[model samples]
Target: MRLNRRLFLGNGAAAATTLAAPALLAEGGGKPRVIVIGGGAGGATAARYIAKDSKGAIDVTLIEPSRAYYTCFFSNLYIGGFREMDDLGHTYGALAANHGINVVHDWAIGVDRDAKAVSLADGASLSYDKLILSPGIDFVDGAVEGWSLSAQNAMPHAFKGGSQTELLKAQIASMPEGGIFAMVAPPNPFRCPPGPYERISMVAHSLKQTNPTAKIIVADPKAKFSKMALFQEGWLEHYPGMIDWIGEDFGGANVSVDPDAMTITIDGETTKVNVCNVIPAQKAGHIAEMAGVTGGNWAPINAEDMSSKADPDIHVLGDAADQGDMPKSGFAANSQAKVCANAVRGALTGSRVFPPKFTNTCWSLIDTDDGVKVGATYEVRDGRIAKVDGFISAPGESADLRRATFEESEGWYAGIVADMFS
Candidate 1:
C-alpha cells in the first residue's frame, strides 16, 4: 500500500513510507504501548501517526497538562490582531475520538527509565515499550537578572503561547499613550530564532494603530538576528522612527529589569518603561531533565531517528531535542515526529522503514500582507541532521510576492494544525 505523506505538510510535499516488520503483540500480552509526553506539535504528531499507522498494532497514550494548547508559531499575528487566541488554540479531542488514542490531561512528573515507566502528578504510573519526549522549552533560572517565574505577570515573556500571550497583548493595549515599551531579547540557540523580531514588528504594528507615538526599545545580546536586513527594512518602511534596537556592541548584552519598579537597565543605565517583555535564556523542558536524557540544557538525540542518545528506547523531538542544524520550530518538530514515528512503528510492527527526509519553513508576518520566510530540506549525515538545500525571502521583494508569502503562511498554519490534531 502507498501512503502519500505530503498531506501532512501543507505544501503537497510527499514523503514515501515503507514498512518491514511483522506485527507483534502489545508490551505484555497486549498491543505494544507507546507513551508520549507533551501534546504540542511533536508529541501529538508522534502519538497520532504511531497509532494511525500501526492500525491497531500499537497502543498510544499522550500526557499533557493543558486541555487547550495554544501554538507559539503564529502567536505574534494574534498579538498584532490579525488573528484571535482561539485561532491558535487546539485540543486533543480529535486525537482521542477520531484516532482512538488515549489522551491523559495530566502532568508527567517523572520518568522511571529502568522500569520503562512514566510517573504522573496524580501518582499513577504507565509502562511503555517506547517513550517520546517533546516537552518543549523552559526558561533558564536567573538567566535574566530580576526576572523569575514570580515576575511573569509583570513582564510577560509570552514565549510559551497560552495565557502569557493574552497577558502580553493586554499589557500592550493598556500601555500609556506615547509610552515606552521595552524588550529584553534572549540569547542565541533559543526556540524560534526569528520569533523576537517578528514579535517586535507585531508589537510595533499594534502600537502604531493605537498609540501612534509610542516608542519601542529592544535590548538584544546578539549583534544580528535572523532575517535582519528583511526585518530592519520592513521596520523602517512601516514604522519609521518608532524602534530603537540596541545590539550587543552597544551594551545590550548587559541588561537587567526591575519588574516592581517598571524599569529596565542596560549597561547600568536604567530607564523606566510602561511595559517590559523579558525573554530569558531557555533550555529543554524540565521533563527531559527528569528523564535523565538532557546534556546541560537540551536532550541530545540521534539525528538518524530522533531517539535519545542517552536511551534508545526514549525519543526526543521539538525544542527539547538538540538535533544539529534543525531549528527548534513547530514545523521541525512535526517533521521529526514523522520520522520518529516511522522508526518506532517499524521496530514494533516489523513495518518497512524508509530513510528519513525532513523539511521546514518558518514564515514571519511583518505587517498585514507583508511576510518573509526561510526554509530548507534536511538529511542525516555523519550523525547530524544537516541542511541539504535552502531558500529564503530576500530583503527587497515586491508587494505581490510578500502578500503571497503571507497567504502561504496562512495555508501552512491551517495545514500543520490539522496535521497535528485532526
Candidate 2:
C-alpha cells in the first residue's frame, strides 16, 4: 500500500501536539519527528510501519550508512555460488518514495538522550520525539587472540554478509584439493545460532564439487547447537567424509587464533589451516552504548513496549535488545519491529496498548533443497520474553518437507522485505 501524503501530514500535525507537546510537534505546522538508527531488519521495518500507520502523523527519518543492505539470512547461497549479490541485496527506494521515510546515508555517532537528539557522523543533529535503535550485533575484539578487524583480511568472519563473504568465498576457491578449512564458532546469545553450521554446509557443498579431498572442521565451544541432529544427518548423508564437527569434548572448546602464524589452538592442540573464519563473541552495536541504552552487550527493554529501561522515549529492538527466549535472527527482529511499532502508535495517539505476542521463524538451508527451521510464539510475562509454543524441524523428516521448507524460506524472505521496505 502506498502512503497517503496529505492524510499523513494532517494526522502527524495532530499527533505531534499530543506526543511531543504542541511546541515540539510543530514549529510551523509540521508532523511529529521520529529518528530511527540503523536500517537493517528491525529499524527498516519500524520506520516503514510507523510512517505507514501514522498516515502523516509521524515524520520518520532512518539513519544508515549503506544505501543497500546485504542480508546475512540467505548469504550462504552466495557463498555456495548459487545466488548473485543482487539476489540477496535490497535497496531502500520503496522506503524513501512510497513510505515517505527520510533515508539518511550516514552513520549515527552518538545520542544525546537528555536532549532527545541523535548526532550523525556528518556533524548534523537530528531532533526526535521518539527514537528507535536497531543496530545489529558487533564482534567483541580480543575475544580471540590475533583475531581482530585488521587480521580479518586474512581470516574473514563472513558473519555480516558483505565483502567479507566474498573474501571467504575466494579463500574457499583457492584451497588446495586436500586442504583444511576451519571455523571457530562463537558463544551463545549471538545472531543466528544455526548460522555457523549452515555456513559450513554451504562451503562443504562447494568444496565437494571443486576440491573433493578438502575437509571442513568446525571447532565449536558449545556442546549442543541449534538443529544439531538435523545438520549432522544432512552432512553425513550428503557430504560424508568432507565435514567434521568438533564439540567441546572433542578438544573444540575455546579458541586462540594467531593470524601471523595462521594457526588456531583448541584445547592445547594447534591445527594450521588453509583458511579460517573466526566468528567472535558479539554484543549490541556501538550506537547502543553511545546512547547509554545497554548493559553489558545488550539493551534491556520492557517486553510489551520495547522501550529501554533507562529511557522510555527510546526503543531498542533486534539483536541489540536482550530478548530472552528469542534467537537473535532477522525473523525475530522483524517480528519485534512490528510489535514496537504498534506500541509506539498507541502511546503517541493515546490509544489502548495491549500486551504483544511475538513470533519468529528461522530457516537454514543445509543444501540447495534441504532445509531445517525453528519457530516460536512468545509473550511478555513478569516483564520478560517467554515462549508459549513453537516447532522445530524433526530429525529424519521426509525429503519432501525438507525441500518445501527451502522454498517457504524464500517466500518468507520476500514477504519480510516487502513488509519492511514497501
Candidate 3:
C-alpha cells in the first residue's frame, strides 16, 4: 500500500527526520556511501533498496539528469491512444522523502575510478565506496544511413520515450489522408527487442481509427524478430492490409531516408512518406565507457551480483549491461538491482547476501484489449546468467486471455513506478 503524501508529510515532521539522516560524503566513516547514476529502473530501485534495507545504515545518493522519468517500455501504447504522456512519467520525490535517498537531478559528466569520485555537470564532485551505473543506451552513429540526430525531428525515432513520442504522435495525427508511414527498424542487441514491431502494431491501430486508408511499411534488417509469429497473426486478424514488412531477404537491410524530402529508399526504390521513424543500432550509455567499465558496446557484468567484470566496485545494470540470457527490459533491470543491492550491502555492512536469481517479462500491446507476452527465469551457470524456464503467449488465444494479459501489464506498470518512486 502507498502512504498518502499528506499524512506522510503531516506538519513536515517526517520530512525533517529524513532530511537529517542522509549524508553526502565519502571521506571518513560516519556511514558508508553509495552513488548511483541514471535513476531509471536499475538505478532508482537499487538506490531505494540499499537505503530502505539498510535502515539508514548507508548514505545513498542518486545522480540523474531528469527529475521526471518517462518509461520507454509501453510508450508505443501512447501512440495508439491507449495512454497519455503523463501516464508514463514518474518523479523522484518519493524516493527521497519516503526512502531517505538523496536525489540529485544533475548529469554525471565524468568518473574518476582511481579516486572513487564522480564529477557532475554542475561542477561538484562526490565520492562513494560503491558506484552503480544504469545509464541505458546511446545510439551508434551512422547506423542508419541518411539519418542522424540532427534530423530526428523530421524523421522521429521516438525510441527513448518523452518528447520524441509526443513528436511522433503529433506527426501521426497530422498525416494527410492516405499518407504513408515508414519505420526503419534497428538491428538486434538494442533496447526492447520486440519494441519496433509493437510500434508498428500501435501505429496501425491509430491509423485504422483516424485514417483507415493510411499505410505502414517496415524495413527490418533481420529476417525474424521477437514475437514475430504472434504479431504477424494479430496483424492479419485486426489490421488486414495496412502493414507491409520488408525483411532482409528483400533488401530491407539496404535502406536510406531523406528527412528534407520525407522519403525512404528500399531495394533501390524511393518513395515519399509522411513520417519515417529510424531506430538506429545502439550501444551502452557513454558514461559507462567513460568510466572505463565497458569493454565494447556494452559493459560485461558478473551474473552472481551484477558487478562489472572490469571493476567489481562498479556495477552495470539495465540496457547498458551485456548480461547473458536476460533481456534488457525494465523488469530485468529491477531484478538485477535487487541482487546487486543485496550484494553491495553485504560488502559494505556485512549483511546476509543471497545468491542471485533473475527474471524478466516483456508485454506488448498489439491492439485494443489484445496483448502478448514473453518471459524467463534465470540463474547463474558457468559464471553467466542462464535461462532456467520460459513462457510466451500462444497465438489464437481466447479474447479473455488476451484481455487478462493486457490488464496484467497495466498492473505491472503501476506497481513498478510505485516500487521505483514510493
Give per-residue CA lDDT, model 1, range 118-230, as digits (tens).
99999999999999999999999999999999999999999998999999999999999999999999997899989999999999999999999999999999999988999
> Order of candidates by TM-score, top first?
1, 3, 2
The candidate that wins on TM-score is: 1
Tell me how many residue pairs clash in candidate 2.
Answer: 4
Task: Report lDDT (Cα) of residue 385, candidate 2.
Answer: 84
Q: What is the C-alpha lDDT of each candidate?
A: 0.91, 0.84, 0.88
- The candidate that wins on lDDT is 1
TM-score of each: 0.97, 0.92, 0.93
TM-score between model 1 and native: 0.97
Q: Model 1: C-alpha RMSD to truth?
A: 2.7
| Clash count per candidate | 11, 4, 0
Q: Candidate 2, 35: how far from true, in Å?
A: 0.8
lDDT tens string, model 3, 16-64? Answer: 1222234433357578899999999899989998898778889999999
- For candidate 2, the lDDT comes to 0.84
Is 1 or 2 the stronger prediction by TM-score? 1
